[model samples]
Target chain A: MARAQWPLQHGRPIIEIVLTLAQGAQKVTRRLLADTGAGAMHDPFDIVLDEVDCLMCGGKPSKMVPLGGSYSGTHPIYVIPIGIPSLGFRDSLFAVGVAAPPAGFDGIACFRFLNRFTYGNFGNANEFALET
Target chain B: MATATSIQQLNRDLADKLVEEAKLDLPSWPLGKFVGIANGHVIVVSDDLDEIVSQLERAEPDPSRTFVVEPGRDYTKVCEIWRIS
Candidate 1:
């Protein structure tokens, strides 16, 4: 089984996953937040990103949809390869790029990604683990 | 299965190179903008999404293959709060 650990900060399980956005040979990697609850089937995307990250990754805007709260607006979606180096995981999924993301996160890793692994939060150890 | 494996392998290789290059080059890129990468090189950087798409259409027609980077944001902070109902 492959396992990875992450720290719990501010009552949130924060883990570093490498995100690779690519078309052909072009690719970029950045660390992102592993958010277990960020997934919403109603949203039309598997992951969420800051607007800049989505566009930089060459994601085309699909139409503005209401996301509720102050976050409502036009959001862009991109189909790209996302990788979690820690788990040796990689897959292509739809992602939403929003104008504003909450503090300290480049993007959120929702259930679409998290559902792939068996995870455990070891608060005592100040870490979380993911097993495939 | 074989095809999937090959694709996975290709993605891994591309990801490895990207991670390495990002560490070396992205530190100097201006923050709060979308940056596009293709052929292992930075192609365009802009704050306007339309501008990025236009440039990418000419540089990398297949957007899925082009990599985009969002520069300068802390990944450690708690961004979304979750509550199970």
Candidate 2:
């Protein structure tokens, strides 16, 4: 089981997270998931992946590239230029985008692969239940 | 030139603008983000305003990450765009 430690603030969850990548892991927080969800935010797919690595297989990914001039800030986001074998691997490569991130890692799950999973928000914790 | 009072005031103003204009369910806090405000409202990406606001509220000073949202500033549309690059 995987867990994340969050802060406890007046018995409310105060973090923003998203769960696009489906992984089976226990969530832990010092406070509560509610604190993370006081407003809209990205899912914590990386944190969840710490425990449950997505075991998906056999999919054709489109070739996408990032525009050199297109940038959000000074930070540089990287993505795979060519499609690679997704199956027989721990985590599959999906589409990448340059957008605002939530808390944990700045990687956003692509909607193409994300369509294969279900999501839930238990207070401040956001979960993605992927199709195995 | 910003005192605690000024921070408090800015926080309140941002909270009000976020609620009234953006139509987002934001919690009241002293944290701040680089919000892009055009006409009294914070500019934000269509699907990420909530995530940005929540992060602003919780993220603390960490040496691992460089970019950090300060407290009492507005982060409307002018935010870091994340995509598969």
Candidate 3:
């Protein structure tokens, strides 16, 4: 199984993923909140990014997303590549650009993103992983 | 871009205004076209995001507080847009 696992660094199951934003540039890693209850079919966003990060990464919107919950407006969506080194997984997915990201995360990995893999501790409650 | 520093320190009121302002003007443009706004003013309105950004680069030197969006797409509901603040 292709799996990427990490301990709950902030007492939460956050994942360390790298974004391939600029070619031949420094590796950009972002810690995202693994929110299993944070997405719906209406929401095409698989992940989230703050405006600065999004723009710095040259994130451009292919779609307009209306996010409910703490965010309430139409935001930009980008198809950015993500890498989970632990799993040796690299692929691109939809990311939403928002203004006020939560307090403790660079971004969020919503259910839509997680649904792509089999994720959980797989037995170790102190850690998390994406089993593919 | 680090969670160690929250974007809450930014001008949230201005950010909200930009998005709201863009939404209000969405109908005036063609569907599927992209719109870019920055510093509380509409900067680039074009057919795609690339064109918008290209025009935006010259229009707004500092686009850290900009908003870009497209029309005629599905509405996504974020059950939780936040982690634990």
Q: Candidate 2 at residue A110, lDDT?
A: 32
- Model 3, B12-83: lDDT tens digits are 344345445656676664444555665545667666545666665576544454445544332443445542
Count of clashes in candidate 3:
1
Give the alpha-carbon lDDT of every model: 0.55, 0.27, 0.65
lDDT score of residue A74 within candidate 3: 79
Q: What lDDT tens digits, residue by residue, belong to model 2 across residues A38-122? A: 1123211111111111111111111122222223332221111111121111332222233433344332333333333332233
- What's model 2's lDDT at B71? 25
Q: For model 3 chain B, where is the 10-residue window of minimal lDDT? A: B2-11
Clashing pairs in 3: A43-B76
Q: Which structure is stronger by TM-score: 2 or 3?
A: 3
* TM per prediction: 0.53, 0.21, 0.62
Candidate 3 per-residue lDDT, tens place, A16-127, comes to: 8897554355678899888886776435577888867766665543446676666787787764556788788776556888886778788888888788899999999999
Candidate 3's C-alpha lDDT?
A: 0.65
Ranking by TM-score: 3, 1, 2
TM-score of chain B of each: 0.53, 0.30, 0.49
Interface RMSD list for the candidates: 11.7, 17.0, 6.3
Candidate 1 chain B has its poorest 10 consecutive residues by lDDT at B72-81
For model 1, what fraction of the real interface contacts is kept? 0.08
